[model samples]
Every structure is written in C-alpha cells, then in structure tokens.
Target: MRFRMALYPLLGDLKTICLTLAYLYGLTVYDASYLALGKLLSGDVYTADGKSSKRRRGAK
Candidate 1:
C-alpha cells in the first residue's frame, strides 16, 4: 500500500498556475485599450452594461 504525500507540492503547483492565469488576465485587461480594434469589431466600446453612453449630470 503506497500512501501518497504530494499534497504540498501539488498545492504549490496549483498556486503557481493560478498566479500565472491571474497575471495573464491582468495583462489582457491592461492592454485592452491597445486592442480596441477587436472590441470595436465586436461592437460598442463605451458604456458599462450596454445601456447608454449619455452621462446624466449630478448623477455621480
């Protein structure tokens, strides 16, 4: 019977993988502005929920 004890190593690897994913996501969002072509092609670039671009005064 072989009882596995690779928990620590597995956890460390998982942590590294998660960090890398987060890093990539952050980079993508950070460079989103530079990739405006794609967004424009997809459609509207402004507005948070695709509602309206007009900002009402004193509604901040």
Candidate 2:
C-alpha cells in the first residue's frame, strides 16, 4: 500500500503544521501532521491494525 500527500490540498502550510502537531502530540512532526491531516479531512485514519478517530460524544 502507498500513502500520498493527500492533506496538502486541505491544509496549505505543511512544514509549519508538522512542527505544530509534533510539539502538541510529542510525535515526529512530519508523521504526526500526516496522521492529523488525514483525520481532519476524513474523520478517521487507518493503520496497520485498524482505524481510529476522535471520539466525541455529542459531535457525531
């Protein structure tokens, strides 16, 4: 399987985003931003094991 930079169009500035997400989540910025952007655009993300998303009780 391959992953594309699909979040770029949705979120313009990636370099800054990487740093921001990394700092917030204590993850490698690029990797954290990639996953963050995916979740923002798609509402969920798929990993090797399964899928995950922000669990909001009243949002959905």
Candidate 3:
C-alpha cells in the first residue's frame, strides 16, 4: 500500500480568509479553517457535525 501526504502553509491570505469566513458564518476560526482550505483547493469539505453541514448546505 502506498500513501501520499501534502503540506500546505497557512499564510496571511488564507488566515485572513479563514477569519472572514468565521465572522460571516458564525463559526469558530478552527471550523472556518477547513472551509477556507477547501475553497483554496477547489475541493469539497465534509464534516461530522450535522449542524454545520446543514448550515453549509443551506448557504448554497
């Protein structure tokens, strides 16, 4: 079996975007970080938290 890992630095722009997402979505910075990263990578974000998932779906 093989696995791959990629490291991404959380720089100023990403940090600022996370902070903005946190404020706009009423989410903690921690949660917003996931969203920010997903947006940056043009990928989807999946969460175990049902409430958060619901909120995200509703936002779309």
Candidate 4:
C-alpha cells in the first residue's frame, strides 16, 4: 500500500494546542505538535523516542 503525505500549516489554534500539550506532557513543543496533529486527525502517533512514547502512554 502507498501512503500519501500532505503538509499542514500550523495556525494559531494549533499552536495554542501544541503549547498546552507541551506543558502538560513535559514534551518539547516539536513533539507536542505531532500529538496535536494526531488528535486533530484522529490518527495514531508513532515516535522513535521511547521516553516520549512512554510519557504519552502513561498520560492515557
């Protein structure tokens, strides 16, 4: 199967969400942004950073 990727511009609301996630999760804004986008699209988030992944899972 082929997966297509699209670019999304982060607007004000997304930036705010990312900031909040970063604060709540103790993740960098960059990592939180990925989480925010996953929440927005109702999609799963995959990461190579085990520590961050553990933190995300623990929050749930």
lDDT per model, in order?
0.34, 0.49, 0.77, 0.81
Those runs of model 4 whose alpha carbons end farther than 4 Å from true positions after fitting are 1-3, 58-60
Q: After superposing candidate 3 on the true structure, give the runs of residues whose Cα lies further than 4 Å from its correct spot.
A: 58-60
Best of the candidates, TM-score: 4
The estimated TM-scores of all candidates read 0.26, 0.41, 0.74, 0.78
Considering lDDT, where higher is better, how would the candidates rank from best to worst?
4, 3, 2, 1
Residue-wise lDDT of candidate 2 within 1-57, one digit each (tens)?
Answer: 997743264245555555666666555554566565655556564445221223211
Clashes of each: 0, 0, 0, 0
lDDT of 4 by residue, 1-60 (tens): 999998877888778878888898898888888888888778888888988897777433
Steric clash pairs (candidate 4): none
Question: Cα RMSD for candidate 1?
Answer: 16.5
TM-score of 2: 0.41
Find the 10 residues in a row with the least total lDDT in model 2. 50-59
> Model 2: clashing residue pairs?
none
Best by lDDT: 4
Give the C-alpha lDDT of model 2.
0.49
